[model samples]
Target chain A: MFNPPTELLPTATNQSGTRTAAVPSVGGRTGIARILLSRDTVMIYALVAFVIYAALFIPRFASPVSTGFLLLDVIPALLIALPMTLVIITGEIDLSVASIAGLTSALMGVLWGAGLDIGPVLIISLIAGVLAGAFNGLLVAVLGLPSLAVTIGTLALFRGLALVVIGDNAVANFPPALTSFFTSKIGGTGIPTVMIGVILVAIIFGVVLHLTPFGRGLFALGYSKEAAIFVGIKVVRAKFWLYVASGSVSALAGIYWTLRYSSARSDNASGLELTVIAAVLLGGVSIFGGKGAIPGAIAGVLLIGTINFTLRLGRISDVVLIIVTGTLLIASVVAPSIFEGVTKWLHARRHRRTLPQASASGATRATASGVQERK
Target chain B: MTLDTSPPATSETTTRRANGFAAVLRLREIPVTLALIALVTLTYMANPLFLSQQGVKDLLLNATIVIILSVGQAMVIVTRNVDLSIGSILGIVAFSTGTLFVTFPGIPIVLVFLAGMALGALLGSINGCLVTVAKVPSLVITLGTLYIYRGLNNAWAGGTQYFAGDRPDSFGALSVDTIAGFPVITLIAIVVVIIVAIFMASTRPGRDLYAIGSDPEAAKLFGIPVTRRVLLAFLSNGVLAGLAGVLYASRFNSVGATTGTGLEFDIIAAAVVGGVAIFGGSGTVIGAAIGALLLTTITSALTAIRVDKFWQQAIVGLLILAAIVIDRIARIRTAKKLRLSEARDV
Candidate 1:
């Protein structure tokens, strides 16, 4: 049902802005259709379909209270994911996010338990997060150690620090005012301030990634460190800042988690780094780095949340949900390859049909004429 | 200029001697083995009972499962991939093997081992398909499967735990039995190490794995069948992890949902500490196995000395840092030498 003229595809020299004028008519053009089947587009459609389905079936799914709850739940992860998306974009990972958050949470708990106020605790936590990130950044960007190895080592380092600071105990019973502000509804809208904070952070990330030169540099660095350095992109500094950003965002998540739970524990968010990463992958961010968007990641978070909530509501066993999630993950990755194969097969078939038998006649006629001349 | 008084033969000899020294240093385990010996000696001074027959047995027995898993994990990590689902796989197979033993009272214990391995292989192949055929990063694919497998185990077990009384004497004996004054399980781990070492050093496909992990895109360009080899790596890891699970079950004589929870990190830690680069392309199976043994031994010795559990985490963190520092120095020296060689070649 879809085909395109061979000439419509751009050649090597078509670098000018006027190339759009050469676009073929839309009817039966497989090129545009293939573009629609791109991974990002597929994820976007899947997310939209899920949201619509949720809104239709679940009575309270669209209500202010539930929406507020969902947004609040996703805020910390979204904030952490913002910087992680950038870090991964630049071809690195921070496995220490959860541990860093745990450390921050413990720091907050210990300070508050010792009779400090919320403001100072928050400041200290943020600073700690930034410093932790700087440590990782320095190790990777300056020392040139592999990010994975460095991060894994820091995972234990940060977690151990949290343990030493907190010393095997849970802290709860925060001042009512602090906890209230964290969980409070904004008048009748039912959305908490924390959710607002997360949205603002996401917006900032989106603008930065889309409008800034640093964003483009990240993509360049991911594609090739040698090329980025050759082009004077300040690869090391860019990488260092990426880690710092990831650390800061993870701290923000930690603060929100502490506020929401009204407690700070050393083991808070244990094993959560995996989920944050899963959201990023599901959002269509290439794990290989250099491609992603905040909006796509937010959509991915929502999809996961919906799936989790819907499965619970449906009373399905956890095992079934796991199997389904596994299946979904596999399908998501598999679909692109399948689509590419089909497109290649169609292109080959089209080319074979388009070539004429008269080409054979021409060759024979030329041969016969040559023979006559020789005779 | 300072050495101008020295003869050219003296300088050449010095260069050769330096190269020889480096070859010895390249053995990788010298530092770690020394550290392990120091730790053991210190523990013995702190309490001679730590080296007693039972203490030694406890250390070896505890280290066996982790050693097995670490050898397998080294294989995957060397290929620049990870198997996060190994813990979950261990959990599922452990419980499944237990459940099978319970349901079929007449089934031979030997068959249980085969069945456990088969189940693990099946789960691992699923990961391979998702990672290779689907082209997903191993991290995400394995993370999904981690939860999926754990959830399956949880639901299947239904909060039920099989206790020591439920299993036959043969099952427990598999772990407890001694061969020439060493636990049979420890011997099994050693056997695993020897086999994997041979495979890694003597096989064509194994060398290809190193090439792929060093630079996957380059490997593809060199016609290495990148996806197929990666899938095989994951499969091997899965089977080994399953075998570890069986060993875990046999040793403890207990199986439950929580069994093997959070164990993947320990396996990873051993591999990393053994000089297996987390980003892949370098490491040794024997090094990884020794790393596991060292970690387990330290834990047992520390507990015997009545050290606080909190100290365990601190020590582990410090050890990891020390290992990374050592790794960094070695990598820099290697790079400098390689650059020097290239300059000379030019």
Candidate 2:
């Protein structure tokens, strides 16, 4: 029999785990780098590239007025996406955001129509949003229904409630002060107060998601629910907070929407959840959860907004834009899978060349025996 | 293999709990069925004309399209997927069939039916490819397609509608004809349900669907062709939705891009109310059929009572909530049983 060295033992067992880790990192990071120049640095570069492209290609695309319009238009999506990003990172999703936004708008409309003061209307709207969120949290966190399914039902439920509340009526003419505060730019410089609100929310959530204990716990929950529970994270409470946050933010978006449009129709923002989700996915957040960032989501919104604006400026038909959005959603999902497949294929080839020759070695022979037994 | 190999005490307790819990949850549907029957009875009592054979036929006819759509929706939902684009698919197929009839006025209605189903299957395959090959979540993919399909239909059928006068009398007869005091359309829907029920319950592919839905990764590890099966599920769902579209065209005798707007959610609601878990795995085709009947009956009941159309949406919402509640209760019980068994194993 051939003598084998003891030092080679670690390479035979624990080395496989390290090998697996290294393979993914190389493929994910290095491969991403070669394609886009750098994995972590690409988002910033892309954003910059977009701004430059817009400025060069589209007239007035870099103007303050255009910037303001983009910011104002995308603010509601950003506000809602901040909390949605968190919930998704925690391995759950909130399909009811669009519905919640609709319901809140309807409630605001009803309350305003009923002659409630601004303070009371706002409070009621927020309360309504919170209660709806709590209902979702209870269903998923307490009763343990899958979030996707629960939210799908509630998507209908909440939107239906909105319809019942407003009943096809459009509510316009909010108090002048409210509109001024929410919709007006800073001294005609094109930066709206609502945009300011979005920025603040983004900065705060960015810090919380990347720096805080709760944020890490949320990620841990996403990575492995059982492990998170074992590690003493209040997984249920985290989920509850996530839902509440999602709801509150969605309600805020609704209020801003009312301010901007000065109208609250039940169908207002109907199917908006699709765009919100597409943005999140495009931002590089895994649909399976446990991996993503607010910055990425913001980047996604910018990318999508830029794409839409560019297409419009180019006078592309709305039909083509819709197709492009669909294509983007498809691309985001497929890219990672293709990347993974290629890496796996390469890694398998490498292993076959390097390890198969030593297949009859003691431990290798044992694994082969195990495979045979399993068969 | 049948006996859970958990700790004996916990396993026994878990088995007992699982049995009892399933029994209670299963019986919950009885109330909805009873309520449906009672409503029908009350309507009959309130207006004897409601019990007339003609009225029964009318009710069944109105419900047939939705019932067919719900069956397809249930199959898709069973795999933890949703097809919101079905409404658009239905619109596209219905209008296309109408246009085909208008263009080829010489063709038999049967050929038109096949053509509509084939087109639907083609659209569904698109959805399946986007989902399986692209690895995108079905919700986003279907949502995008919902708009695309609707937009295409609108563009193609813009400023136009196909009416009863545009189609042959025999084509219209599919919806209007009666057999044994029942509309042929409803009978066709019933036949569709029976075929779907068998496919879901008895076949190997059908059972594999439950496995995939229950745990996709686990199923894949166990050597299930996860992507292929999911793709097929979506394709089958698409085809059925398309078939519903064809029937819809024949039933309504008027087709346009707006033909099936918003029907997707309604069909999904029926599936959920039928006790099919939206997350996939456990559910019954029969339950979906009952759900369809319940929803359709409610609409007729509302119409019979002369309630406003607005109340219809609200009532549908209430039913969806009720179904979700039932689903939650069942899930909790199942989790509890699993936990108990796990405890025993420990």
Candidate 3:
């Protein structure tokens, strides 16, 4: 039942060094039009359309003040989402990202309160994150444990450690200069100065994911681990490093969150994993892995941020925002499959009409339709 | 279906296979049970009052709600699917139970339970339908529903909480009254575990669940109704969660939007630690029940021994990781053993 050529053909590398063959050409169309209609492009279009709509219809939405708050709000999600896009592309998840951030925040608060200078405190907090990531990588990558279960464990473990570190306490006496710098805008753009750092992180993840041989290997790993190994991808090492990167980025988000809010607490960023995941999924990333883009994920983060900000501006409750997010997540994954099913059914019906004699035998009709459906 | 027609070698292998399966089942419960006993004994040694009648009651009561939830969760997990919205389902149902008592003022307890369970079934079927028809992973679907249901609960409960005082004394007594040294709610959980365990062990449909979970494609090829079985699992899970919710309303001081928030993780952790495989297919409700008991006991034991309460969660996390690692090791050993045995036969 296994077709050797069908399995082998896609793994063949082309001259451009991109695994472009892995992406199926839609509707027999090639090149620019196909790229334009892809899921990532569609997500970008939706983000643009939603932004325009919010600007036109919502009051006070077009101002730079709105931009400042929206971008600030989405920064943590945008940061974590960079590595999350890669993780999901490789068919695993790290639910502990938010908890790692919480742990980092708690560590920062405790270290700062214990009379440590801010510079060393920041570095130690990030190292703590890297260690947490390594622990996860050790379990999931090295030991071959399921990432979901392992991360769920670490999710509680890290948060629990955070609670132990800062028990029901909030540290708010951060240096005023650093805090102000965190919220400071560049010139008259109303964007936070911290955004530059976030952008650099995003770019690094994007370049690694989309421009490197290692990133191509990640896609192959997601599609089929055995095949990835066959093609000489160091699947285990790549996954291990991806998790480390995720932890480091999550820690950075933690530092930014603490300074931007000027508070460090154990509960910092609790429940944020959901929002990060929802945004990533809405960005055209397949949860089953092997498909996604960083730009689309950034757009996803911003689109959600804009919607929430506009709703907040309109005096709408957070409840509605939650509902909107959940609905969007479900629709994003469900819509494509439903569209494909409809197309298949329509194609089968048309074929039946054209070849009336084909429907004479039930078995023959089923086989004919199935074969056409594959095409 | 008759094994007598098979050759002697085949029959011998089948018998050996049966023995191995039985051994694994028995082995799954041993470690958790041993751990639970060890924790209790150590707590007792630290503080004799830990085993006092009141302390014992408290431990059972603490575990009752979790035990009920974990049993339900084990059923869904056994089907190779998960229902992350159980916490939200419990929240909504608990709130509804509270509201029912507050509004009706004199409603029968049975009617309230029915209403809560019916609501849960409705919600669960929505999840089941979406998951089955969508062909999407249960994780994503349930995660979406988790947010939507929690959002709805927030909208509905909006700072309104019904306390234990709002319910009738009889309803409150469900957690208070002890029958043969067991709280009524704990007894209810025990009965649920027993009944569900029997259903799982003896029923054809129950066996089909294990098949579907172990390998969904193979199960489908073998003519198992994967969609229907999976939907049933979710429905039953919802009903049990609803039952837990009503019990929550009775035992806890208040029921509101945030009543069951974050409980899903604890329940999942319990199921996993109890030896219900996280990826599904080979765990029993009984083990999960013991796992729930073990976790709740750990919290009480820590408090009794004067360990910092903050360390409880960390310990639980470690326990989960340890359990998964152990399960993996055991599975590998079994695979190796089976390979060696098959090689000898060849």
Candidate 4:
């Protein structure tokens, strides 16, 4: 009784062969289609396409020298984006990352200027970042304050503290060995030596996000906090640790930024947060959370870095670069929703057309059943 | 009948509930107001010159643009949206105002103001369309426009900056001219705050914005035109930002590509500190105006007290954190009270 006869199923399908064919294979083939058309895949494709385009058309952009410069420029953003991808996936933001980096740089400068050993200065700067992140975690995760508001406050506070620490002084007397080491490339390859460290960070973040139970819990937490709690996910603890990670990673980026430039100033990596966020979002991470991958995010960072490098190599003004990044950020978000809306509308239209036939058959079946009951 | 006895109980609860709501409304603006007064008094005590006529004038002038911007921002925030592009809007418009004077030396000041506002409205509509039509979050869209508009300004104004000397004397006098010991520009900001406060408090569309912010899905289900109201909020915000830009041109030393860069954070901080919920649904233009006053005064106060001026930004940051934490605590207490009252009713 539960399974309809094969003959009856054909009657239902007789209204439209095309509809039958379209509807029956949704379970298997559509899954493959969806995977292929996913935002991450699209981002990877775009990244590859743009690189090829740049290498082909842009003069001097294909060279190893440009590759090294570009990689060096994007290292800070790339490093920060790793932990940022996790934070965003859990549906929070850390606008203070750049400020934390700035503060770290300022502290390093001050400590180094005070004749402290470089080793201790670096450790203290990183510790300061951890403390800053802990402060944010206390407010946001423990106290339940909104992350957006909390981070904006910290953004200002950290940057302000940076100003007080350095007082507009730029510390440039870093040991020459370390500065050159930051810019040094792998032998025979144009990629910065720092890329190795960046890639390692990326791989660690990827494994944590894609493989671990804690990461799976974050996806659930992003979708519904109450449900996550019901499932025993330690929401507060998870978020606190994410904030800590973001802070520590930002500090690492700050260190890299300072050494690469051989300068530590209050404004070091000041606006880097926006660029990192833009890249992450462009990588197909849902701004609302619960979606994104490390590889996609890496592709996003490289894509923007390559575009900017190409533009600079072409002698285009920075204005165009800014505009392009903004446009791409908006387009990346808007395009997906628009596509979804269109698909939904199309599906609705198809359902509406098929509804009359469905109801007619339903009415006939109801009459037959009524006759049988009466008999 | 039970009805006879229930009437008195119901009436008593009704009056109590009404009082509770009124108290909450008063409480929202009280903390920011108290902070402002305390800061001013303490600063004045530290250095009498802090409240001298020139000092007072400087404070008012300093807050004028921020006050205007925050008042506008309150409208958008009230509807669960934000406009980060206002800084960029102000920058582009201020530069245009400068360019107008540079190109047409005798252009009427009123026309420039109108032009700036119109441009702001146009830019704002783009944000509104992207948000309302595209169904994207306002935060992301505005962030995009922030960069895009700033880039446009940079490309247009490339190394050319219009200074105070570039504008006509009368144009600059708008900021200089005073009435009743208040600079004309400051008066304009006051009028803007008052007008916006009234509109938000007593109008249907304004109240609808609050409803939308409180629960967007419910607001839509209730037949409120959420899209149109949100669009209107953005439109009005744009107009106010434009007005601030024209005033910014009159008051500041120079107008260029980066004229208003980084001002968005300050405007947002003022609104948040003023009691405007960053998440939306509650906050008043008046409170935000006071917040603007408080923040700008802190800068002057720190300088006057010979405290490191660097502390000003840190103080502003601390105030924002304090404001939001207070807001959270208040919300929790209110919810608890409401639940207890409901249990009693049952």
Write the residue-wise lDDT of candidate 1 on A1-375 in tens digits. 111100111120122223223222212357778557545666778878987887898666767787677767766677788888888777788888988898899888999899887789889999999998999898888888778777877887888888888889989978888888888878888777777777888888888886798788887776567777998999888888888888888888888888789888988877778778777777777666766777777777667767766666566665565666665665665564465445445533453477544235443233233223222
Best by TM-score: 3
Q: B248-330, model 1: which lDDT tens digit per residue? A: 88888579987898777778888888878777788888888888888888778788789876566657766766777788888
* Least accurate 10 contiguous residues by lDDT in model 2 chain B: B1-10
Best by lDDT: 3
Worst 10 residues of 1 chain A by lDDT: A1-10
C-alpha lDDT of residue B164 in model 1? 69
TM-score of chain B of 4: 0.93
Point out the higher-scoring one by lDDT: 2 or 3: 3
**Model 2 off-target regions past 4 Å?**
A1-20, A26-48, A187-189, A351-375, B1-32, B38-58, B134-136, B154-165, B215-227, B257-259, B303-311, B331-346
How does model 4 fare in lDDT?
A: 0.85
Across A197-298, the per-residue lDDT of candidate 4 in tens digits comes to 888888899999999999999877775677779999999999999999999999999989889999999989987888898999899886767778888898
Off by over 4 Å in 1: A1-42, A345-375, B1-22, B215-228, B304-306, B342-346
DockQ in order: 0.28, 0.28, 0.48, 0.37
lDDT of 2 at B327: 73
Shift of residue A269 alpha carbon in model 3, Å = 0.7
DockQ for candidate 2, C-alpha atoms: 0.28
What range of 10 consecutive residues in model 2 chain A has the weakest lDDT sum? Answer: A1-10
- Chain A TM-score for each candidate, in the given order? 0.82, 0.85, 0.88, 0.87
Can you rank all candidates by DockQ, best first? Answer: 3, 4, 2, 1
